[model samples]
Target: MPIPAMTEQSDPLCLSEVTAAALLFDAPWRRFGVVGDSLSAGVGDPTPGYTNKGWADRVANVLQRVCPDVQYLNTSEFGVTTARTVAHQLDRMAEFGPDLLHLPCGPNDILRRKPDFDEIEKTMRRMYDLAARTRALLTTFTLGRAYVVPTFPDWDERIRAMNAITRRLGAEYEAVVVDMWNHPVNDRDNLLSEDRIHFSTSGQAVMATEVVRQLVYMLSSRTSE
Candidate 1:
């Protein structure tokens, strides 16, 4: 069965009807790049045809529907940290020269036994600087919902601290920030997979919808200026 496209009328996690309409972009995107860890590599979506079809793929599909010329590339891997991404993924993502770059790291880093905040911030800044050099519309997100918070008693605090740094980095680097804490999708359940660590199929759809909405709004606003 084909996964249904997200529309405000049919969306389970709808923020508003008009929000979907706003995602209809006037100017098309050419190239889109994705960087991060397993989420970016699409770990939980499915292996329908032996390919990991996750949220990033869903977002790319939506972009291609409106802008067929858009090319997509994802350099994310499982268990990758901000430090590893800066060392391994940043240069390659910049080489892609995507019109828009979606970066979602820090999850893997924060999940570690001993996460170094200073190192995380520095590595993230390096990644941000590399993206800035490309002049691509760099975007990132925060984690406010974790299914396995109980497993790691201290994870909530670490996630909160990480989110703060993410917002600050977005502001300092002028990258687009997807504020998940304020997004309506958080109100919904069954979005996460059985493990609760990764997004479920439905969750992936919501995420893709959010990414498209933000990208369209950001691009349109820039064009108007």
Candidate 2:
């Protein structure tokens, strides 16, 4: 079957698809926006109308249940690397502003022979600017174990370094970071698609547990302060 094109009004997150179940938490947060690459784009899983694995869409689902007032924007583009991530996010921030921005990106950057770390940093800085302009709380998603292998020389180090950069960007911008470098969801092969890079529909559901757990906690922490 052919894949249908996603729409602007369409939601890219699918916490429901993430089957971990435990990561889902109840909390109150206003509407938000999500930005990133293919993972955030919900590229792999097939769910007829919507691929139920994008963490952004999943968080939106959880928010709808926990805080109906919560809304989110998904600005994900398939095949978008770190360079593209910053550009796309900055552009989106100009239009559909959100209270929060959930970003999931960087894998593609590692695969490239010439990783543009400097360019990546510049883009992240720009992302921070958009976050400021939108007054949108910023947050991010890290790769699960499947995405990284520390034993490797070039790939692992570069990925970890990029992750460090991501964390730094989050902290500098005063944003929350959702780190999933090693999670149990990958145990189930059914959750991972053939590509291995992308999560299986079932696997996406498991990832949702992490996304919601962290997001709701962030909202709670904000409220406490």
Best by TM-score: 1
Q: 1-225, model 1: which lDDT tens digit per residue?
A: 998655434666533323443465564567889998987776674412222347677767666766778899999988888888888987888888888888875888787777889888988888888878888878887774643556678977887888898999998987878777556665556456667687665556666667667777777788899
lDDT for residue 27 in candidate 1, whole number 0-100: 44
How high is each candidate's TM-score?
Answer: 0.83, 0.75
Which candidate gets the maximum lDDT versus the true structure? 1
Tell me, what's the RMSD of every candidate?
4.9, 7.5
For candidate 1, list the clashing residue pairs, or say none: none
**lDDT of residue 41 for candidate 2:** 67
lDDT of 2 by residue, 1-225 (tens): 986543212433333423323343444347667677888766565533434455556667766665566767777777777667776566765577677677654776667666778887777676677667777777776766676444445776786777888888887878777776666655544555666668765555556556666666776676799
Task: Please give the lDDT score at residue 70 for candidate 1.
Answer: 83
Q: After superposing candidate 1, which stretches have Cα over 4 Å from the reference?
A: 1-9, 14-22, 45-53, 223-225
* lDDT (Cα) of model 1: 0.72
Cα lDDT, all candidates: 0.72, 0.64
Candidate 1, number of clashes: 0
